[model samples]
Target: MLVVKQALPCETVDFPLSSETQRFINICLGVPVGQGYGLTETCAGAAFSEWDDISVGRVGPPLPCCYVKLISWEEGGYRISDSPMPRGEVVIGGHSITKGYFNNEAKTNEVYKVDERGIRWFYTGDIGQFHPDGCVEIIDRKKDIVKLQHGEYVSLGKVESALQTSNYVDNIMVYADPFHSYCVALVVPPHQALEKWAQNSGISYKDIEELCHNDQAIKEVQQSLSKAAKAARLEKFEIPAKIILLPEPWTPESGLVTAALKLKREQLKAKFKDDLNKLYQ
Candidate 1:
């Protein structure tokens, strides 16, 4: 079998690509694959990684079509005065900005703003870190951040993204209750990876559902989750102490995710009420 190696410039839009996945793609394709950041409100053109940038994670500097700025989000623990770099809510302003929603002035007033200089700005509600190299990394979403019982702020989306990089995790949802000091996870393990692991660990199971219930399997999954969290440099409390493994994956058909494949968190919470209770217990 002859496999021809090909190199082409690639760019990912819409979703924020994980650092691990970006690096993997770069290596496998023998080309630098850049990730771009934008919102529908901004006409889908904001920041984009340079094709020559071999580094991973950042979405590069703001495009000339728009101006980017960071506003302090104290509640989410991201401030513009952060030591190593400035981190805050990313705001996009300039020509590429949307005018307003159709027939909804109230909704428009909430996120759309006009500065003293007559520049239009859109509050993206996305937390970002600006690097010295002029690149920006979208780290978390304001709506997805929660306060733990200890008053520590944790970004559920951030934690889930980090954990999803684990080989064992096919999908994951991080749950945090204000009544609890730590977070937990509902994970869907990859079938092939989980089966191979179970076999290596001398565990027996008729199917994925049976393997999900195995004590040793659960322990191994937890370890993998921890390893991924540590690798992503998540804080101590950010790590999920307990996890509930689910055999099924979350898809749009399951009502757990949107048509775009984004998680419908409220739906997940409602559907996994019992599993969540068990994890907390």
Candidate 2:
């Protein structure tokens, strides 16, 4: 009796719970679920815990069967460690560890290395920190932390999550460029929802683009976003400074979004750099 919602590649009337219309039985439905972090090289399921308010972004404590540690990466290689440190790449070892990559000794040797204690540990590229409560909070991918000109870093995941909560926002991709002062969102509104709102508000639109430019429609969308921001407890920097409604939705085939639904920040920035600049100007 579990109801699971899986991320989808395209819009669907009733979203599938697994791979391309495939459905899998989810044990933690209606009940709170736990999140875990690991990699293929680590044999997966490195750490997890029961769902809790404090564990929102946490991957929970290390598993009983496995040993986990955070190692600092220097220019050439990794630094050894044992004690629970704040933040770094996650390394796993013990009974659950995988032997090595198949027929790829070079790649295998690079990720699976032994520590001073002669224990084999698989290096997971994901970046995270040990929480004060002994859980692990995944901040972002090692590469996704965008440093702004003002020396502040923004988590693109956080901003994207906030935008996704807007009812009118069907899909969105956000990015900031070296030349821009703030981030911009390429938004695709829910056309049905927008049409209903417009009709009720007595507003007429020649097309989707015109609807987006309508003052009242814009106000409604903005208000929805403002409310969603508060509800999501988004930080000031994690909210987009401005949004541009796109004529069509971004799709994998279009190369606007990745198969995992993550925005290709570099590609998007390059494609819309001019539009983003216009916003600031």
Candidate 3:
């Protein structure tokens, strides 16, 4: 017999969680899982979604111990004057905030600020939008953005996050080249999902590597990617024009990702230089 832990009424996530992932988790666990937004500098208590909010992608209003502010970044096209919702770089000020990084004055001076009222503020590089309900939703980041040949900027992190919600995708790394008009992706397909897809399509494959090279398999994965991107309302240029499927999972041991599972972009780009060239071709 198998045993399972009792489902609690509420669960919380600290890292970025997609709306689709959150909904799926809520359905699977039979509990309301809310997302919280905060950094280590804020003592991890900036804002949290209410369990009953029922809306996706909100990190709730600012907590009593902290206050949240948004300032415009013109280069990124985010502004406090954005209609319907205000969007800008999220700054947190409160009693519980950290002073600065230990013995890193230059780095500390870049992000930490003191207001005229003697209140301390930390300039979180995370881009956010404040909804009418006063809740904050993380929309982008200050880094990991690329400009395409057409001069339009795309946020690589946002694209990856949206596409990773696809059932066929275990992980994804989106690449953009300034010389190329379109973006391309390197996707790590879920083994079980790809196997099931192959079976359903009446395709025989000796291994995952062979299957990844199959034209039909590649087409299906691309279709899945396009569907997810459209569902997420990504702009037309933001959608990848091509993709390279990797049979192997990127791991910390592989040096493609950090211990925290964050992508090491430079390493990945270097490792797949030839593949990326082919993609552009």
Candidate 4:
């Protein structure tokens, strides 16, 4: 039996594997894949993928005895209201759905609304759609889609995914700045691995700061960024023309990363506002 887990968009290399180990696996072993999805509001195991390439970012069709729908909203946003649709929020209502929030009726009322039909539905914050082939493709999180200068929608996840494919990158956070033409990235490298590589290649550097400021090292990082952009299939506008190498990793103590290690994008942007301004200037 074989099991594979797709790398996260923010993860540059096989995190569980060492740099040398990853190279060996990629050269000798085949690809790896796996699937699982759940919502904090939903109990767990709401949807998942059993087959390969069913659809990217989909939680497969609803499980047996589960009900899913794409409900239309009177307001601007569309929602997975009740099923049979190509797009909308992913709402689930069935035995698996949670009844309501604890001691927070108002919060519960906002998501678990009762329709005229008297049926209960849990409004999943994720936006997605069901495919013709019976798969679900998560388009974007309700909050992750940013309108570009041209009014086109860009998925931050897509751009971040591209950046993560770079061999030199450890993790990255990509976000749009209202004042810039393109996006920007706060890049974190696998310092230990990169230092080893640098040493092995006879590229001496005093420290990470020196490496980041080194013209040749910057060029190598840029090349990795280009490769990531290509792998992610990003539009020209979506690519970050500028990247800032962070001096340190984002952590909960720094209030830059979430408990789950996800970037606190808004906070990161605000924290690096001056650096970003310098780039634009």
Q: Say which candidate scores most in TM-score.
A: 1
Please give the TM-score that candidate 4 achieves against the real structure. Answer: 0.72
Ranked candidates, highest lDDT first: 1, 3, 2, 4
Global lDDT for candidate 3? Answer: 0.90
Candidate 1: clashing pairs of residues:
none
> What are the lDDT scores of the predictions, listed in order?
0.91, 0.67, 0.90, 0.66
Q: After superposition, how far is residue 45 of candidate 2 from its true place, in Å?
A: 2.4
Question: CA lDDT of 126 in candidate 1?
Answer: 93
lDDT of 1 at 147: 95
Q: Relative to the unseen true structure, what is the C-alpha lDDT of residue 171 in candidate 2, on a scale of 0 to 100?
A: 82
Q: List the residue pairs that clash in candidate 2.
A: none
Query: Could you say which candidate leads in lDDT?
Result: 1
Better of 2 and 3 by lDDT: 3
Cα shift from native, residue 239, model 2 (Å): 2.5
Per-residue CA lDDT of candidate 3, range 35-94, in tens?
888899999879988877777778888988988999999988999999989999999997
Q: Give the alpha carbon lDDT tens digit for every residue of 1-281 in model 4.
A: 54546542221211122334434444444433323455666677566655443223445666675667765542325555435556777787776768888999998988996668766678876677777766665555766767766565667876776678787778788777655567777788888866766787789888887776666666677678877687667788887777777658778899988776777878987898898776666
Model 2 RMSD, rounded to 1 decimal: 7.6
Candidate order (TM-score): 1, 3, 4, 2
User: What TM-score, computed on C-alpha atoms, does each candidate reach?
Assistant: 0.88, 0.67, 0.85, 0.72
Whose TM-score is higher: candidate 2's or candidate 3's?
3
| lDDT tens readout by residue for model 1, 27-145 | 87577899899999999979998989988988989999999999999888899999899999999999899998999999999999999999999999999999998999888899999
